[model samples]
Target: MSSPLTLAPATGGQRPRRLLVVLGGALIVATYLFLVTVQPAEIAGGMGSVASLVTLFGFLGGGALLVAGILPMLSTSSLVVMPLGIALNIAIGQIAGSLGMQIYLDAIGTVLVAVLAGPAAGAATGALSNAIWGLFNPFALPFAAGAALIGLLAGLAARYGAFRRVYLAPVAGLVVGAIGGLVAAPVAVFMFGAAGTFGTNAIIAVFRSMGDKLLVAATKQGLLSDSLDKIVVFVVVALIVYALPPRAVRQFPFARTHRVLGGRTGALPAPSPVKAAHGGGSGVA
Candidate 1:
């Protein structure tokens, strides 16, 4: 019979790093909330472009801090994956937006990173992707928080075995997308005044025509588009993961440590009797 795997507790040294990640994530959320809710005269008046810049920098700073915290914890392989993930998010997201697809396929790379690296790294990827994309596409700036949340949630889902079965990934995605929509609605209503991508804008316009308030319309549109987008993204990521060679899959420390893909998990073997006799057995049973 195969031994049951147990996740080791975080070491004392890791606690500080974990704290840094939490603080950085908190900073991102706080900055976004301040911008959306306060609507400072500087931002609300004639300086909309400045607001976009602020949003970009705020999210970028937070993401950079989070990545700093997560750097020591990542494997070299995971580090290599980050840039590719960012590129994937930008390239696919731009294409989908250009095509006027209602569902944003932007989070595929974020989810992919989250599933492979862990939540913190995934969150960093999502936040960074939006910050960089915002440089060229100002529209993406306001949604950085939502993107980060999606990444964080995707990693958590993977950690909890959401990817263990094919069907469960979509279910997890559905939940993540619903929450993402909630996170995004205020940005749509307050920042853009119901303006968004083609599909979402059309949906919001239809809702408005039907007598829904802007906030209500934005929220509904977000729910519809985000949920569908996430379901598709998660399914695609699952297929990609499954298609990878077992050796490739095992290279991801997060996946192997957590048994996310259900293999041997690479836990250290128990000492042999002879070795134990020569050296004492480690206290672990």
Candidate 2:
């Protein structure tokens, strides 16, 4: 059998590229904060479209920079996988929202990309997912920062072998969910006045009725919603990834390099001498 395709070894520029990814993610979050806090409240009424435009462009630009940094590292498989991830996120998230479910399983694709690619690609996927989804649902725009956080954390969790077992995935998801809630709470409360799905609003109202502050109530609601959603999402992602053919999983350079799926050390098998003689070499797939 032919050897699996292998990515190039780490290069000196990897650090700089990673730095760019960090900067891009930060910029996206920063833009979100600026709009929510710095912009006048009037923007909510007369300038809502403009504000939405700013959010869309902010995420788009940040995503661009992030994608540029990871471009070299991405395999052809990743290119194909990203769109699938985006589609899954939008379709499932919309369905959940329409049903007014308590949890939004929107970040499944984001977590999947992070597992297969890396933190940067995962973050970009989340940011861009919201930006694109914003076209159909503007409410999703403000939460791009939170989405990016989920992607970043999920990728980090996978890098550290969180997906090595089925149970560990939910633990990682819980951690990601908390951080995501922290980031999303302010956006939801300040921008939309805690407006969300029926279940989400009901949770916030319960907290409010219990004498919790508005922000605090919204925060609790976010924590509960995000944490529960991520647990299911992470578990689902783990199962889906593990169910994939090993050969297909191995196509992801990040997964192979980090042994994310917990297999034989991700070491590439020796190339066939005959293929080598014919100038055939492994390429990123």
TM-score per candidate, in order?
A: 0.75, 0.74
Cα deviation at 215, candidate 2, in Å, is 1.4
Clash count, predicted structure 1: 0
Candidate 1 residues lying further than 4 Å off, grouped into runs, are: 1-16, 27-65, 94-102, 263-285
- lDDT per residue as tens, model 1, 105-159: 8888999999988887788788778878889988887677678788889999999
Q: Cα deviation in Å at residue 83, candidate 2?
A: 0.8
lDDT of 1 at 242: 81
Compared with the true structure, what per-residue lDDT tens digits does model 2 show for residues 66-129? Answer: 7667665665677788887889898887888788865678899999998998786787688778
Candidate 2: deviation at residue 177, Å? Answer: 0.6
Residue-pair clashes per prediction, in order, are 0, 0
Angstrom error at residue 244, model 1:
0.2
Candidate 2 total steric clashes:
0
